[model samples]
Target: MTRSSHSLRTRDLGYAQRVCVAKAGKLMMQTGQLTPRARVGLAVSGGVDSLAMLAVMAIRRRIVPFPVELLLLHLNPGFDPHNHRPLVELCAGLGIPAHIETTDFGPRAFSEENKKNSACFYCAWLRRKRLFDLCATYGLTHLAFGHNADDLAATFMLNLFQNGRVDGLSSRESFFSGRLTVIRPLLLIDKPTIVRAAKAWELPVFSNPCPMAGKSMRHEAETWVRSICAGDKHRNVSLQHALGRWQLDRDALPD
Candidate 1:
């Protein structure tokens, strides 16, 4: 990339970053996910989505009223040995503390012994468990994921179609008896916006090394959703609004 082009890209990314931080900060305040002086861990997967989340969080921390100590936590599933260095370097450049863990979850999940469990399912389960363990070990209050509006919509569709329920992902969820919380600050942002930001910022986005990257049920749901929304640009917006209202209604019901 040339210097002039790089400068323009940085300028564009600065604008995108500002928008992301503003939206994310508002979500954080409304959800009350992060408290002042709280330590939060970002689950960085070296992908565009997670990298964008990392950038947004870093920017939001400086501008928000409360103080949040950000930490980068990565779990290398041993799919690609060279996949994690960019994540570490990004954390270093951001001046945040980072912890990277390696495991053979990828290989093991794809092994013959685990034929019953899909590779995608097994990998996700192991990665999430490892993240929870990391939070417990490091005393982090919250773990932030890179799940966006598309993911939420896709999940909603998956549940509605497969499980016969109107369930979807939540922006904030408590686990382990409220000892730890999982938050998704990008719930209101769409994948296209994230992709633009990632490209503008020149993030070192890495591809998923999993053999079944595009063969998962989630991917199928995404494709279906896109096909449904092909002509109507407002379809996703409608889905997000409906999902939010449904969640609110569910929350209001008696327990």
Candidate 2:
């Protein structure tokens, strides 16, 4: 279908919102995370960030220079009393194809067999492995995640304080010998902007179902980072960049 036809099916998110979306798309393009005819799988978790990312990506495809295919992929962590209807409905409304599957990652991570590793680590690893498998099976060129600037800042702090290393999130990183690349178009965008957009755009966001929600070490780090960046967005951004450089330098060192 033509761009105009596609636009007709999706709601007009207004100029301001469109600008936000365009800004994210531009950032991805500048970083080479997005390219013409790229096939991307969006790893949506039904949270505010992921939901907004999925919508923005779909909208981006309709307006970009060349045709790009997008597929929404959601892996349910087998949390009881959870519903994916909102996500499904949103994808249907946007005319985007989605693949939803349930998994025992959460349970397995919390089970007795998970004594060696923390539940968070095991669950994330399992989910990531499944995502990579899905990308390979579906012929996806890249996998897009919804991590924003705030997430980057928190991640840097987590690595430094918890792991005693300098590391930060990357905007784009290749995986499995470059068979599939992971991209974060929203990396430059802040969480507040994403939260506002999710509300303003009425994204079908849902709360995270993981039992460790708001209680993980990452959560504690994020809270601390949030307090540190209380009224200084620039500080948060600067910290990420500065620490990210240190990480690069660290990686360059010889063992």
Give the lowest summed-lDDT range of ten residues in model 1: 1-10
Best TM-score goes to which candidate?
A: 1
Clashing pairs in 1: none
Candidate 2 clash pair list: none
lDDT for each residue of candidate 2 in 80-124, tens digit (9 for 90 to 100): 535777777677777889999888899999999899999999999
Return the lDDT, model 2, position 138: 95
Off by over 4 Å in 1: 1-15, 248-255
Highest lDDT among the candidates is held by which one? Answer: 1
Candidate 1, residues 1-255: lDDT per residue as tens digits?
432124233244566655666776767777776888888999989888898898888777766787789989988899787778877666666778999978899998988868788888888899999999999899999999998878888999999998898788877888999889889888767788888877766778888888888899999999989888888988877877777656545433234
Question: lDDT of all predictions, in order shown?
Answer: 0.80, 0.79
**What C-alpha lDDT does candidate 2 achieve relative to the native structure?**
0.79
